[model samples]
Target: MFVSKLFGGRASDTFITRNSGLISHLIPGDQVLADRGFTITDVLPPGVTLAIPAFTRGCKELPEHEVTRTRRLANVRIHVERAIRRLKGFKILSNIIPGRIQHVDDIVTICAGLCNLQPQLIREEIEGKASDLDEDEHIDEQQEGDEYSWDMAEDIEGNHLF
Candidate 1:
């Protein structure tokens, strides 16, 4: 199920994430997959993790493990981007109706429902191929076991650490 909230265009992603009540629904150990723009690590409830692509900072290149993790994250993030694209496809969402501003939440919920009624976003065959790649890479058991963790931390300077 999809949960959504309507916020003004000027609202920051971190603000919306913290105030939208979405965090309340998450439990300890829940991992939130998000884009680099979502810098709400400090606001996340205790034990809840956030995962985003690794930043190279001033380094010449990211380590091999970071590269692999980033590739996996990007592959999964593609589906999320596609879902947003589908949501935007609705003409009602293209232009705001001043008169229906109060009902924007309902409209978004209905549109999300309609999108859910469509075919599965990722097919089983494609998923199998991804697993095949992982096997070919000979991923370690420890990394495989922590696949769902996606632990991310922020340093004292607010820079994200993988």
Candidate 2:
């Protein structure tokens, strides 16, 4: 799943996603779960869906269904974040990659492979139960008022910048 090259730290998420070659590997009916920062709907192939949290632009609060979807998405993202944390456990990845390194991608791929070979992060029983949890059940223990920043850039049309 490592489809993109090692990009600089300043690269935008959408820009990296566009050049990642990840879309080519996906087929129709596939859904790409992403963070709100990635506004890649325009570049997605036909029949592919992008799932991100709903934006509460003009509303005081998100609708019930949107809240449910956002919670579920956040629950799923926890595992993804854990996997990334495991990948970062490697000493080489913990530090900033030197600019002179020409084969950084290969090294990262090898490290990822090594991480994959380790024990599964989530046990099957727990994973199954996690999926079965009710939509209203709060998985994340984040405090109230501690929300992600909504100060995102927008295009001339008032749409979120990609």
Candidate 3:
């Protein structure tokens, strides 16, 4: 969520609140792929098939397909994070704006839409190079595990912590 804010991605306190009046555009079984900010609710249409890392906290045993789909969704979600990081490369998105917090939402969405219109900033060419990885991208990764591919290095202590 931090990377999204830094990259001009939308920031509503509750995603469900922000998505209010927006979910109407989507149909049933749309394969919703979202971050953990979204609450799992039965109110959503049946067969929607939400693909998010299950953070049910000590809940025993999930369906095999849920685990498999979550993994696949995780891989694809990286590109979205990359896109947000690319947006944050611009300075306007980095700074916090005063006045309306509501405007912040608009700014983020506008910047994202604008970013979509722009060309690729970081071309995927050579390997063995740094990635435009965002800090928020690994939140889910860390939710399940203390480690992540997105970790830059040690945290405070020099013990190679994630």
User: Could you tell which candidate, 1 or 2, scores higher by TM-score?
Assistant: 2
**Could you tell me the TM-score of candidate 1?**
0.72
Question: Candidate 2 lDDT, tens digit per residue, 1-162?
Answer: 243678888988888888878767665655677767778889887877777778898899999977876776676556565556667778886664678388778778887787666665544443443436665664453322232111221211222221
RMSD of 3: 12.4
Query: What lDDT score belongs to each candidate, Candidate 1 first?
Result: 0.62, 0.60, 0.44
Per-residue lDDT of 1-162 in model 3, one digit per residue for the tens?
Answer: 221332234655346433454444435534455568566454456644444566546778767756544544454455455555655666665776666565776777676676655544323331112222332333232221112222212111111110
Name model 3 segments beyond 4 Å from true.
1-19, 35-38, 54-68, 97-105, 119-162
- Give candidate 1 misplaced runs (Cα > 4 Å): 125-132, 135-162
Q: What's the lDDT of the predicted structure labeled candidate 2?
A: 0.60
- Give Cα distance to truth, residue 89, candidate 2, Å: 0.7
Of the pair 2 and 3, which is ahead by TM-score?
2
Give TM per candidate.
Answer: 0.72, 0.73, 0.46
